[model samples]
Target: MADRDKDSSAESRRILDRIAREADSSGSSLVSRTVKRARDHVSAADVDEKDWVDHLGTRIGRVLGLVICVGLLAWLVMFLVRGA
Candidate 1:
């Protein structure tokens, strides 16, 4: 049991070491650090507010048009079925 525990611990340590080295080599750690710094330094006012309004308006118009078209098609179909 003791030998098994020792081997498991050593294997865990080696796996962790490999992961750490791979992260460092791939520059993921640097990217994460840079993202943290950017988030910390970012101000709400730095973002564009107009883009939000424009995006919302565009989405609303698309949804409204879809609803209108669907309602009109349903009405037309119902009217034709009743006539037949």
Candidate 2:
């Protein structure tokens, strides 16, 4: 074989060996993947239906209270201004 053919054959074998090793693995040997999984788990919400309902109820209650407070303040201002 020629010198160029020999060099190309060696490079082909090196690349094939690398591909075989990567194909045989579980593909999760990277620390970045593990860290990403941990970060996703930490930031994930574990809320149930009841928790969602409770949160919604709390928000609605606050909005209702704000409306009531503003209404009462308006009424008080009117009462003082009208002197009645």
Candidate 3:
């Protein structure tokens, strides 16, 4: 049992060290990746062959969806606060 525990601990340490080294080499932080994703989503870069009108509509739709979600969240918070 003691030998097994030692082997497992050493293996776990090695795996964690490799992960840390890879993360350091990649050099892309969480905030930067999040920002890049948001930019791509808002700009609709994933949509292919879209004209200006289509792009504008997509942006508008995204904004409207966001607004609706915020409104709903606010209403929920207010309802909870009021105990209604």
Provide the TM-score for each candidate, comma-separated: 0.40, 0.40, 0.56
Question: Candidate order by lDDT, highest to lowest?
Answer: 3, 1, 2
| 2 versus 3: better TM-score goes to | 3
Residue range 1-84, candidate 1, lDDT tens digits? 999999999999999999888777656577788877655434233435679876566556666776798999999999999998
By TM-score, how accurate is candidate 3? 0.56
Candidate 3 residues 1-84, lDDT tens each? 999999999999999999897688468887888899987887777666548888788878887887899999999999999996
Candidate 1, position 4, lDDT? 100
Q: Best TM-score goes to which candidate?
A: 3
Candidate 2 has a TM-score of 0.40
Tell me the tens digit of each residue's lDDT in model 2 across 1-84.
699999999999999999887666577666767788655444332324467776566556666776798999999999999995
- Enumerate residue pairs that collide in model 3: none
The stretch of ten residues in a row with the least summed lDDT in candidate 2 is 40-49
